[model samples]
Target: MTVGFVAFHYPRPEDFDDFVARVHQIAGVLRSVPGCLSADCWITTDGDDAVVSTGQWESDAAFAASFAAVAAADVDVTFDERERRPRQIIKLASR
Candidate 1:
């Protein structure tokens, strides 16, 4: 089974560009991690302050290990004092 993680963030109105640029920078790093199958960053079309990033891993263990690295790097971002939620993990299944 492929393990996945979703991270949600809310950016400040004035920091929208900064938020997107930072996400792209992080995505590049995420793609280089070992056992990482794929990674993507997305924004909603409604012009909301929210963004979601998804990462696919080879296994649950691989996902957890990559998160440890992210945590050690203090990768969490806060915009307009909005709270950043914890990463959610899920198992991906094909149709």
Candidate 2:
């Protein structure tokens, strides 16, 4: 199995809740894609404007294919231009 993660940092705390909802919505879209075992959203406990999304896929190809499809769809949800980062992570030490 392959694990993927995306970390998002909001430029403005006011948009944090909305961003979390959007991330969850993205996870919902991925749930229907083939080989996507699961997707989840997480937030920090210290009330920081950060969110992380984790996804489990059968393989790297599956992950790439699904992401391509989403990109092709041209979904409109977006965050502030000043957002800190959208870090893409691959394979984070599975137990």
Candidate 3:
């Protein structure tokens, strides 16, 4: 399986609600993509303003194709300009 991890940060606390709404839209789009196994969003409640998305796919190719579609549609913009949070992706290996 291929997995994707996305990170987001909102500098303004007032934008939390709006950020969640945007996350919902992104999750919906991911679910509609072919070969997407699952997609979920997580928010940190530890006084840190960050949101993360974890997505599972059938294979790396599946993730690439779906992500390309997302980028093409300009749906990957979830962070505010003031937020400097960095996004990272990792590939897991089975033992």
Candidate 4:
């Protein structure tokens, strides 16, 4: 089973670029972690003031450890202030 960590952020319009740049930096760090299958960031299409980041890990433990590393890095951003949650999802269904 794969694990996902979703982070939602509501950033000011003026801080959009900064937020994106910081996320890019964070993504680079995350990609280097072992067992990190994929990591992506998405913005809403309807001019919403939020961004969602999804990270897939090989296992639940891997996801937790990877995120711990990210938190320890303290990349000059306050992700803790954002809404974050871990979820387990079924990717496919058999008929």
Best by lDDT: 2
Q: Which ten residues in a row have the lowest lDDT in candidate 1?
A: 79-88
Per-candidate TM vs. native?
0.70, 0.73, 0.73, 0.73
How do the residues 1-95 of candidate 4 rate in per-residue lDDT, one tens digit apiece?
77766666666777767777777777766767898887777776777756666677888777777767788886755644332332222332112
| Candidate 4 Cα misplacement greater than 4 A, ranges | 79-95
RMSD of each: 3.5, 2.8, 2.7, 5.1
Candidate 2, 1-95: lDDT as tens digits:
57565555454566667777777877777776898888888887777656777778777777777677667664645654645655445454244
Model 2 lDDT-worst window of ten: 86-95
As for lDDT, the candidate ahead, 2 or 3, is: 2
Residue-pair clash count for candidate 4: 0
lDDT by residue (1-95, candidate 1, tens digit) is: 77786776666666667777777766666666788788888887876656777788887776777766665664544434532443343455333
lDDT of 1 at 91: 51
Off by over 4 Å in 3: 6-11, 74-79, 82-84, 87-95
Worst 10 residues of 4 by lDDT: 86-95
The per-model lDDT (C-alpha) reads: 0.67, 0.68, 0.66, 0.66
- lDDT by residue for model 3 (1-95), tens: 45555545444567667666676677777777898887777888887877666677777777777777677675646544545455454544222
What's the CA error at residue 89 for candidate 1, in Å?
8.1
